[model samples]
Target: MKVAVVGGGPAGYVAAIRAAQLGAKVTLVEEGELGGECTNWACIPSKTLLRAVEVYKEAAEYLQDLPKFDWKAVQSRRWAVVKRLREGIEKLLSMNEVEVVKARAQPAPGRAVKADGRVIEADALILATGSVPAPLPNLPFGGKVLDTKSALLLEEPPSSVLIVGGGAAGAELATLFAKVGSKVVLVEVVDRLLPALDADIGRTVERELRAMGVEVYTSSTVLSVDDRGRAVSARLKTAKGEIDLEADYVVVAAGRRPNPGPFADLVKTDERGHVVVDGQMRASAGWVYAAGDVAGPPYFAHKAYAQAKIAAEAALGRKAYYEPLAVPAVVFSDPEVASVGMTEDEARRAGYDAKSARVPLSISGMGLISGGAGFVKLVYDGNSGRILGVHAVGRRVSEIAGEAALLVEFGATVEDLALVMHPHPTISELLVEAAELAVGKPTHIAKRGP
Candidate 1:
């Protein structure tokens, strides 16, 4: 099979490599750097910077007279990380014998793509053009108004920043700036931060952000912005009332929109312009496939990787599908938040007799020693005792999400989780503890009457 993959992102590159591994001749077309936004801008860069803040805050607890943060050095290191990863992708593509073309590609008729005035014929086409930052109303990206990509490129952290939207990016940025001593005012149109996750997760994150001196205004929207060259003044309609704020920069982290390029007209797209794909990651046009942010939400690189693998295999006449029982969502904020499967509300809405148990991280020996706060919540089918979801927020909780995902994926029960032995003095024990509570075998916390 001859495969042509568009946009060398997490989705495209992975699809190309997989297709090549399946004995297909593949050509990957990308206008920008390989690894796409996740590698160059959003995920990798942001996490790199956030890790810097994490280290500083961890050291501050025990050290005295810390040196001032060097933004330039951090920026250099962030780029270095990006560069190294990009080279790794390049080498992978080369070793796999996947041809890479550095040019903008357009889907041509008859399972072909046109790039740089050349038509590349293929038996299957994979679209993974990724997405761009969604612009906020009355606050276009320019000058002091920044998007997530541009915000990371700033030479120095602003003395004050007003961030719009309280999703993963907004919350993480708020954490990054506030922890580094920048006054951050975060505004989310929704009622809570990370509105897509469990309500408690948002509440925990909001509490932590407030502790970091980040002014959070949920159920709010920025009405207008008046950029005055040096700074920007924004009028916001918050839950309390209308308020005005000034900041060195106004960052619009509202969300992202699919960058499907010329393929939108060729394939089925949802109302949000995301290319609609089926279980096999096949577009309405059976020969074409779409993955990553361009395909839909829960826009994580890992999700892209899974979908890309399915798309490549299915496209190459293999029996693969993009069916997953649980896909993990993680936010790298202070006291990181991670969740898998449905929330309690979602489980009930899905027609399950859902019940949940919550156990604070403080109950764990490691959590107490590590100064961790927040709780681990397990939403399960009350009748069957099968674990439906796991949501957690705490220091290093991100590591637990993999196990949480597996529990939901394999339909493990609360009893199963409780029976499994977790290493002693580890934060991961919170899951076992929560499971024990759910099964009426409470440990490390006071038992409640049924």
Candidate 2:
């Protein structure tokens, strides 16, 4: 059977490769260059901008420990990296034996896709078409009223920026602006920064941002933005009533929506405009599968890849299905954040009697090695001893996301992880220690002898 994988991104390309691996004639279509929003705009570009910020922060804050870092040269080289990576993805799709079509994909049911006035019919269709930056209705994004995408594209950093959201994207960019020497003040409508993150993790990051001189406001709203090409004046709602905040730029990192309206009449998208898909990434409309950011949240690239693999299998008349145990998330902020599985709230909602343990990384061996400051939190069921959730916050501690995710994925207990030997003085030791601590049999802790 022939398959047409629409939207050439992590999802589309992975699906194409998977379909080809399954011995199918696969053709992939994308409106832009390969890698979709990830390479072109979202994940990849955001990281490019933050790399500059990370280096700059490391030089000043971690100078003695991190070694000599060329701040100026490193930041300047991002464009070259982005340019090279973008080209590499294009080349990868070409080498995959999947015919690549660069044209806007018009989604149609029953394994049909239209592109730039040409119709491609296949036995199966994979709609990996990605997402767009969420619209700000009253406060529209323009030249000065920027979104995360535009914020990354600036040749020179602004003097100051007022970020309008305190989620992962907003918080990361706020850190970026601060590192690049922008006087930044992040405003969130919620009670805390990164409401999506666990309160403890969010608090840790919030404290770090405050220590870095980035002003954060909880329970605040930007009423409207007055854009004047070079600056934006915002009327905001705060505890002390209305106040005006001025900045060189305003970033709307509040949210994102599926890039589906173009293919609206063709697929079954939910009320909120996200493409609805079953376990195998199959759309309600037959033979049309959806994956990636367009599919839903916990919107990590890895999740999309997994979904794409299953979508490819299902498209080929294989009886494969997707049963993801854990979908991990890592935020690329200064003292990064990572999580997997359910939140405590999620477990409670699902009617599980849950318990969680929070550990500050200041006590870990790896934390001492990296001269650490942050935490590792493990949330699990009290009765079952099965891991339900895990959250981490620390400087470079986010790299251990894989190990943390593994424990959640396998339902590994604290004692189970304690038996596994971890490399001495590495960040992974923290995960081992955190899990051991969970079973009330912590190796490193002072145990009361029987």
Candidate 3:
């Protein structure tokens, strides 16, 4: 089979490589860097910067008079990390014998794509064009008004920044700037940070951000923004009332719109412009498949990878499907937040007899020693005792996501989790602790009164 993949991003490149591995002749096309925005601008770069801050904060707790942080060195290191990863992706594509083309591409009527004035014929086409930042009205990206991508490229951290939106991107940016000595005022139209996750997770993150001196205004919207030469002035409609603020930059991390490119006309798209795909990652058009940001929400690269592999295999006459019981999400804020499967409310809404238990990280020996303040929450079927979801917020909690996902995926019961002897003096024990509490076998913490 001849496969032509559009957009050399996480979804596109992975689809191309997988298709090639399955003995298909593949050609990957991209106008920008191989790893796409996640590699060059969004995930990799932001996390690299955040990791530096994380290390510094960890060291400052014990060490005195640490060397001053060099913004230039940090920026250099971020780019170096991006470059190395981008090269690795390129090497992988080469090793798999997938042909790569650098140019703008458009889908044609047949199972073909037109790129740089050449028509590339293929048996299947995968669209993974990703997405572009959604700029707020009257606050177009320019000058002192920045999008997430432009915000990362600033020569130096602004003295002050007013960030709009409190999703994963907004929350992480607030953490980055606040830690780096920038006065950050984060405004979110939603009721809390990370509104998509469990409510308690957002509450925990908000507390941590406040401790870092970040002014958070949930249920707020930017009414207007006026960019002055040296700074930007903005008016906000907050929960309290209207408030005006000025800052060196106004970052619109509000959201992102799918960039399906020319394929939107060729395929069925959601009201939000995301390409609609089925369990097999198959679009309405039998010959076309879409993955990644262009496919829809929970816009994590790992989700894209799963969808891409399914699309590639299904396109190549395989019976692969993209059914997953749980997809974990993580926010790299201070005291990282990670959640998998249903929240308690979601479980109940779906008609499960849901009961939940939450235990503070302080209950764990490692958590106490690490001084991380957060909680592990477990949502389970009260009747059957099956674990439905696991949500956690604290230092190194991101590492617990895999175990949480597996338990939910396998329909493991609270007893199943509590019975397994987890390693001692580890943050992961918090899960076991929460499970024990749910099963009426409390350990490390006193049981609540009935």
Candidate 3 runs further than 4 Å off: none
Clashing pairs in 3: none
- The CA root-mean-square deviation of candidate 2, after full C-alpha superposition on the true structure, stands at 2.7
- By lDDT, the candidates rank as 1, 3, 2
Query: What is the overall TM-score of model 1 with all chains considered together?
Result: 0.98
All candidates: CA RMSD (Å): 1.0, 2.7, 1.1
Predictions in order: lDDT: 0.93, 0.80, 0.93
Ranking by TM-score: 1, 3, 2
Lowest summed lDDT across 10 adjacent residues in model 1 is found at 363-372
Residue 202 alpha-carbon offset, candidate 2, angstroms: 0.8
| Number of clashing pairs per prediction, in order | 0, 0, 0
lDDT of 2 by residue, 413-436 (tens): 766776789887777777767667
Q: Over all chains combined, what TM-score does candidate 2 have?
A: 0.93
Q: What is the TM-score of each candidate against the true structure?
A: 0.98, 0.93, 0.98
Identify the superior model by lDDT, candidate 1 or candidate 2: 1
